[model samples]
Target chain A: MTNIAEKLNISEKLIATLELEKNSLAGTAHIQAIRKTALGSFTEQGLPHRKNEEYKYSPVSALFKSELCPAKQNACAKLTKSTIAELRIPGLDSHLITVVNGFVSEDLSDYNPNAKSVLVYNTRNTAKHAPALFEKHFGQYASNDADAFIALNTAAFQDVLFIQIADNVQVDKPVVILNVTTTETASLASPRNLIHVGQNASVQIIELYVSIDQNASAINNSVSEIVIETGAKALFYKIQDDCPGLNLITTTQASQKANSHFDTHTVTLSGSWIRNNLNILLEGEHCESHLNGLFILNDSQHVDNHTLVDHAKPHCESNQLYKGLLDDKSSGVFNGKIFVRRDAQKTNAYQSSKNMLLSDDAAINAKPQLEIYADDVKCSHGSSTGQIDEEALFYLKSRGIGSESAKALLMLAFTQDVVNTIRIDALRKHAETLIEKRLSK
Target chain B: MLSIKNLKAGIADKEILKGFNLEVKAGEVHAIMGPNGSGKSTLASVLAGREDYAVTEGAVQFNGKDLLDLSPEDRAREGLFLAFQYPVEIPGVSNINFLKTAIAEIRKYRGLPPMEAKDFLKLVKEKQALVELQVTLANRSVNEGFSGGEKKRNEIFQMAVLEPCLAILDETDSGLDIDALRIVANGVNKLRSENRSFVVITHYQRLLEYIVPDFVHVMYDGKIVKSGPKELALELEAKGYDWIKKELGDVIEA
Candidate 1:
C-alpha cells in the first residue's frame, strides 16, 4: 500500500488491493525476487494514459477507476464440471484445460501427467517443482519495461500456466485452454501463461475467454509468451465471447527460431471493451508468420487490435489481414506495424485492413506502419473503410431477398477471406455461425 | 399483360425516358431496337423499379395492377425480372445459394411453403442444362471472375430458375460474341411459353435471328417512333439506324 500510495491518480487504489494479497502469497526466494522487481517497475511507471503510443486508442487508465478487488479463487462457486461442459465447442475433440478465476482446475483439465514428452504445470507450483525452468523463461519475452499492464500482471498475478513439449514430438490433438471469470462483485483477474514448443515439434492451441455470470462486472488482463524452436510449427487461436460487463486486454508475445512457422487467428465476437496486442519476432532466418483477425461488434462495444512482426533475420516472410464489421454505435481500431532490420534482406511482408460500418453512428480508425532498413525487401499495405456496396445490395434485393438477409450475405462474404485463413474446421465453422447469428439480428 | 403510357423517367434533374408508350400481350416477344442513349435501357430500369430513376409522369400496368406502387423486391415477387446489361459480380455469395433464397422469399410472398432441398437441387440441374451452365460455375460466387459469355448465360439461367412472367432483357447482347449470343438466345427461346412475355432490348439484330420476335419497335429520343413486324429489325440492321434518324429529322429532339 505504501509503495502504490506514492504513485499518481487511478493506479493508487489498484496497488493498495495488491499489497493486501502480497502478504498471503507463498513462493520461494527466487520467485519473490522476481515479483519485487516487477512491483518496482510498476511503481516507476504507473497505468498508461492516452499519451502513450500503444494505449492511444484504448482507455486503459479509466478502467482502474472502478471500485475493484483481485479475483478470489473461491469466487467461482456458481460453476461446476457440468456447467462448463456445455460451453465447449460442440463436436470438437481436444485436450481441455479450464482455469477458473486464474486458478488452474485439475479436476476439469484432461491432462495426463504420466504421459511422457508433454507437461503442464501451474506457475504457483512451478516455483517449487521445476524452479530452473520457471526461472529461465518466466519473464524472458514479455518485457516489464515495454508496458504497464505487463508489469502489473507480473506483480499481482495469482496463478500462471506453463506448457512444454519435448523435442521432435508432435501432439495429435490440440490443447484447449478455457479461461472463465465468475465473481459476485467487481473483480479483476490476471492470468499469465508460457508455452514452449521444442525443435521439430508441432502443436495447436486455442484460448477462449468466457464469463459465467452475465451480470458480473470484471476485467481480465492476460499475457502469454510463446517460444517456437527451430523447425517447429504452431497454430494459436484466440476467441473472445464474454459478457457485456467485462473489459479485457490480452497481450501475446512470441519469438521464433530458424525455419519455424507460426500462425494466430483472433476472433472477437462480443465484449464491452477489448484491446489485443500481438507481437512476434522472427529471430532466425527463414521463419514465417501469419496474423489474421475478425471482429463483429454491435451495441456500444469497442475493440482495438494492434499487431507487430519484427524481422530480425534475413529471409523472413509475414502476412496480416484484419477485418471489422461494426453496427449501431460500436467502434473499432486496427494498427499494424512491421519492422525489417538492416541485415534482414529478402523479407516479404503484406498487410491489409478492411472495415464495414453498418450504421453512420459507427466508426473505425486504421493505421498501418512499416519501417524497413534493408535494401532488398518487398512490403505493401492497403486499407479500406466504407459502408456495404449499395449496388450489390440492390442486386440481391432484385432477386427477392430481403434487405436484412442481403446485408448479412454481403457481410459474410466480406469476412470470408479472414475465415478461410483458419485451419481448424470446427472452429472456423463455429466462428461463421456466430457471425451469421450476430448479423441476422 | 404489360402496358406503359406517357412514361417519363430520369435520374436526378435530367429526364431520359420522355413520353414513352408501349404495350405487349401474353405469348409474344417484342424487340426494341435503337441506337445508344435512346432510353431503351432507361425503360428497362424504370420497369424493374430502380430507385435511382424517378418516374415523374405516366403510369405502368402489369396484370391490371399499378406496377409503380411496389418495391424492387415486391416487383420481383410479382413475376417481374430484369437481366442486367452489366451483370454485378458479388463475391462470396454462391450463385446456387442466391437462387435458392430468392425462390424461397418469392414463394413466401405468394403464401406458399418453401421447396424441399431435393426438389430444389433437381430444378437447379434442369435449369443449368438449358443455359449450358457448368456445375462448378453455378456453385461459385455470383458472376465473380466470370467471362462475358458465362455472365450472359448466367443471367438467362437465373431467369429460367425464377420463371418470371414478364422478363426484361436489357442489352443482353452488348458484350457477347456470336457463340455466346446464340447460347443466350437459345436459353431465352427455351423458356418461352404461352402465358409468359419478354421485352428484349438490343442494338443489333443478330440476337433476334436465333429467337425471332413477334413485334419490333424503333425507339429514338425516349419515344417509340415506329412499330411493325419482326422484319423491321432486319431492315434497321441492314440499313443501320441512320435511315430512321434521317427520316425523323427535326421530328425527334436530341
Candidate 2:
C-alpha cells in the first residue's frame, strides 16, 4: 500500500543488494560470465522511471510496488491439465512448450525426439555448462544501457529457454511457448528467454502470456532476446491476453545479420496495465525487419507499446505498423522510432501508428518518429488518432444497421489491415474471434 | 409530394435562402435554374436536413409530414433523397452495402422486415443495370476512385434502390460529358413515376434538354426572379443569363 515514490526507494535498495550479490559470483570464464555481467548491469540500472526516453508514457514505479519475488523452485508442479486446456490457442496443439511461474514443465512441452536441426535446452543453470556460448551472446543485443526495465529483468533472471537452429535447416512447424503465472498476492515474476538462428536457417516462434487466476494482481516482467545469423530468417509472434487485474511488462530484443530476415507480430487484448518494448537492430547489410502490433482495450485498461528499429548497416529495410482500438475509459499509447545510423545508407524504413477511440472518454497517444543520419535512406513516419467517422456511421446506420452494430462493423473494418498481417491462418482467425468478442462487449 | 413555404435558412448568421417557397406534387418535374450565388444548392441542402444550414423561418412538408423537424437520417427514412453534387467517398464501405443500408433504413421506418440477402443482391443487380452502373463499381468502396460520371450514376442508382417519394438532384450534370449526361438523365427519367416527384437544381439549361422539366424558375441573388414553363429554359439558353439581367434592369427603371 506504499506510494509509488516510497516503493521506488525500496526497489532501489533491493537492486543495490542484488548487484552486490551478483558481483560476488565467481563462475567459469564462459557464457555464464556474460550473463552474470549483464545481470550486474541490470541491478545497477533498476526499473525505468518516467524520464527515460523509451519508457516515457509507460511508468514502471507502480509495477515495483507489488514486491514480486522469483517463482518457487517447484512452481511447475502447480500446472495442471486443466490449466493447459484453458490456455489452448489455435494451432497450439502441435509443438509447444509451457512455462509456468518462470519454470519449464516437461509434461506440458512437446519435444521432437528425432529432430536433428533444432535444439531446445534449459538455460536455467547457465553458470555450469555452455558458459562460453552464453557469455558471448547473452545480453549482447538487449543491453541495459538505455532501458531500466530490461535491466531489471536481467538482474532478476531465473529460468529461461535456449533455442538454436542449425545452418541451412528449415523448421516446418512453428515453436509455441506459453508463459502462465499464478499468484496468491501482489508479487513480481521475471521470465527470460533467448533464441539463436544459425546462418541460412529458417524458423517461426510464438510467445503467449496468460494469468491463471483473475483477481490476483501480479507484475509479470518478461524479456526475450533473439539472434538471426547471416542469411537466416525468423518469424516471431507474441500474444498478450491476460486478465484485467494483471500488470504486464514485456521486452523483446532482436539482432539480424547480413541478408537476414526477422518479422514479429505483437497483439495485446486486455490487461489492467500493460507495457511492451520491442527493439530490432540490423547489424549487417541487406537485413530486413518488420514489426506489427494490434491492441483492443476497454474499461479502465491501459496498454502501451514502444518499438525501435535500428539500421546500422547499409541497404537494410524495416517496416512497422501498430493499430489500437480503445473503448470506454481505456487508454492506449504507441511510440515507434526508427534510427538510421550515419553509415546505414539506402535504408528503407517506414513506420505508421493508427488508432480509433470508440468512446468519448477513451484516449490514445501516438508518436511515430524517425532519426536519419544518412540522407540517401527512404525513411518516413506517420501517426493518426481519431474517432470513427460520423458520416460513415450515418452511412451505415441508414442501411438498417443499428447504431451499435454499425459501430462494431466500422471498427472491425478499421482493424482489418493489422489483423490480416498475421501469417498463420489459424492464429489470424483466433485473433479475429478475440477482436469480435472484445468489440461486442 | 414535397412543399416548402417561406423557408428562410442560412449558415451561422448569414441568411442565404430568404423566404423561399416551392412545391412539387407527385409525378411532376420542377427545375430551379439560377445564376451564380442563387441559393439553389442551399434550398436542396435545407430540404435534405443538413445540420449546418439553419432554417430560421418556415416549414418543409414531405409526404404530409413536417420534414424540417426530423433528423437527416429520419428524413431519408421518410422517403426523401438528395443526390449531392459532390458525393462523399467513403473508403471502405461498398456501394452495394450503402444502398442496402439505405433501403433497409427506409423499410425499417415503415415497420418492414429486413430484406433477405439473396433478394437484396438481386435488387442491387437490377438497380445497377437501370443506371448502367458497372458491376465492379458497385462492389468497390462507395464513390472511392470513381470518375465524376460514375459518382453521379452511383447516386441515381441509390435513388432507384431507395425509391424515395421526393428526389432532389443537386447540380447532377455539372461535370458530365454529353454521353454521361444522357446516361444520367435517362436514369432519372426512368425513375420518374406517379408516386414520386423530382426537383432538379442546375446552373445551365443543358440537362433539361434530356429530362425535360414541367416548370422552370430562374433564381438570382438568392431569390427566384423569373418563373415560366419549359420554353423559358429554351429562351434563356438562346440568350444567356445577361438577357435576364437586362430585363431586371428595365423593370427597376420603370
Candidate 3:
C-alpha cells in the first residue's frame, strides 16, 4: 500500500495543504498535543490508496488530485429561516442543531428547553465551557489508527460538535443535526462530533446532510465518536443526500458499556462518491448492538458501506442488515465484519447484506465476514446480489398496478425492512417519501 | 359475459389451447374438469392475460371488448380475476397494503374517486371474514409463511375483495384440506351474484359439491370434449377421465 501510495504521489499536495493549515487551525493549548499526534499519524499514512484493504473499493487516493482550500469562517451567514424551514422534517418536533460549512449556527437552532440536562455545543464551546466533560470523552472512542480520515478529521476539522445526555434522563424528543455544506469554490470541511449518553439515559439523534451549491465540488470528511454508558439506550440515524459534486466520507465509532443498547441506521440516497464506516465495540456483558443501512445509487453514483461489530465480552448479541439498490450505471459495495473475541463466549452475531441490481449495467459487490475465536459463540454472515424478482413484479402488476408503480412498490418493499428499524414514525415516513420520489425518477 | 372463439395459445413453441371455444353468460357457473395435461390451467391463465402464453391465433371478448389486446392489469381492472393454484409469496408487502393499492388502481381505471380509508378498512374486514382469515395474517406480508390452507383461503379472500365481474378458479382445491375447501368454496359461493360469472377449473368433483356449477365441461388435450349438466361432474368423477380420453382418442391421435 505504501508502495502504491508512493507511485501515486497524490498526498504531496494534500500534505502541503495540511502544513499550511496547521498554523491557521485553531485549538486550545490542551488540545494541541492531540492534534499533533493525529497530524503525525496522518502525515505518515498519507491518503488511503486502493491497495489498502479498508479502501480497496473506494479509491480515496484518486480524489486527492484537486487542492481544496479549507472552509472559511462564517461561510453561511447569509442563510435565512426559510431555507431551514424547507429542510425541516414535517410533523416531527425535534431539537435542531445546524452545522453550515462545518460551522455551528446557534441562531438558527432550536434547543430543547424542557430537557435541561441535555447539553449540545460545538467543540470550541465545549472546550471552553465544559472542559472537564470534553476532555474525558472527546477522543476516547475514536482512534487515529482505525483510519487516516479519522486522524485527518481530528487534526484539521475547523468545527467539532459535542452532545451530552445526563444520566437517567430520557429525552422526550429527537435531536436533529443538520449538516449543510456550501462553498463558492472547491473546498474541504472536516466535521467532528463526540456524543455521550450517560447511565440509563435514552436519546435519539438524526443526522441529515444538505448542500447549497450543487456545482461547487465540495469534499466533506467527518468523524463521529459515540459513547453509550452502562444501561444507556441510544439510536443514531444518518441520512445522506448530498449534491452530485460532493465527496462524503464519514466514520462513526461507538463504544457500548455493560447492558447498553446501541443501534445505528444509515441511508444514503444520492451522492457522487460516498464511503461510510460504522464500527461498534461491545466491551461489557449483555450488550446489544444493531447496524442497518440502505444505499440506493444511480446515474454513475457510487457508495461503499463498511461495518464492524466487535464483541469483546460474554453474553453479547449483535446483528447487522444492509441492503442496496443499484440502477443505471451505478455501483455499490458492502463489507461487513463481525468479530467475536476469545473471551466473548455465548455471543450471537448475525450479518446479512443483500443487493438488487435494476439495470444490466448496474453492479454490486458484497463481502460479509464473521470471525469467531470463541468456541461457544454463534456467528454467521451471508451476502446475496441479484436482480429484482420477476415473479414478484408480475404478481404485483397482474393486480391492476401499472408497470412503473409496480416496480416502485417492489423497490420500496425491498428497503422496508431497514426503514422499519427507524422508531420515529414521521422520520420513517419521510424516508419512505424520499425513497418513493427517487424510485419514480 | 365472456366468449372465446377458436382460440389458439401456447407457451414457447408448443400449443396448449388448440382452437378452444367457450361462451359464458351472466349469472352462470361453469366447471372445467380434465386429466393432468388437458390444458385446464392454461385456459385459466390465457383468460387472465398471462404473458408467458402467447395467443398465436385467438379472439377473446370480455363484456364486448377484446381481452387479448389489454395488459394483465388492464384485464384485472376490467373485472377479470384468476385465483391462482399457487399463490405468490411476496415478503415485506403487507396484505392490507397490497389490496389497498390494487383496489385504488382498479378504481382509478374505472374513473371512480379513491375509496375512503374507513370504507376500505370496513370492506377488508367484511371480505376477510368470508375466507376466515385472521387479522394477524391480514396484517402480515402477503402469503409469506402462510400454510397451504391459508394461502388458498387468502386467494379466495383476494378474489372476494376484488369482486370481479368474471372469476376463474384454477385448481383452488389442489392442496386444501376438507375444512379449507369448505371455507373457500363457501367464500366463492357467497360472492356469486346475478351480474357475476365463474369458470372453476379442477380435477375432482368434490369441490363442485360445495359450489355447484351450472355446466360441467370435460376438456381433453386442448379443447372441450364433453359438455353436460351438473350430473356430468359426478359421472366423470365416478368413471375417471378414461371415458373422455377413449371418446376423444381419434381426435387426439390425429
2 versus 3: better lDDT goes to: 3
Q: Score the docking of each candidate (DockQ).
A: 0.79, 0.24, 0.65
A1-441, model 1: which lDDT tens digit per residue? 532343354476777777767767656676577677887788788888667888787766546656667777774666777877877877789888888777788777776765677788786655578646666888889888888888888887877788888789998778889988777767778888899999999999999888777334578888899999999999999988755556888889999999999999989988888889999999999999999999999998889999999999999999999999999999999999999999999999999999999998998999999999999999999899989998899888888888888898999999989988888889888888888887787
| TM-score, cand. 3 vs. native | 0.94
Compared with the true structure, all predictions reach lDDT values of 0.87, 0.80, 0.86
How far does residue B135 in candidate 2 sit from its true spot (Å)? 5.6
Q: Model 3: which docking level applies?
A: medium
Q: How good is model 2 by TM-score?
A: 0.86
Q: Write the per-residue lDDT of candidate 3 for residues A276-324, one digit (tens) a residue.
A: 9999999999999999999998988889999989999999999899999
Which CAPRI tier for candidate 1? medium
- Candidate 3 lDDT over B1-254, as tens digits, reads 99999999999999999889999999899999999998999998888877789998979999999999999899999999988888899988889888899999999999999999999989888998989988475559989999999998888888888999999999999998999899999999999999999999999999999999999998977998899999999999888998778767866788
Q: Estimate each model's TM-score.
A: 0.96, 0.86, 0.94
RMSD of 2: 4.1
Off by over 4 Å in 2: A1-5, A12-39, A71-94, A105-138, A296-299, A325-330, A355-365, A386-410, A436-441, B96-111, B135-139, B220-228, B242-254
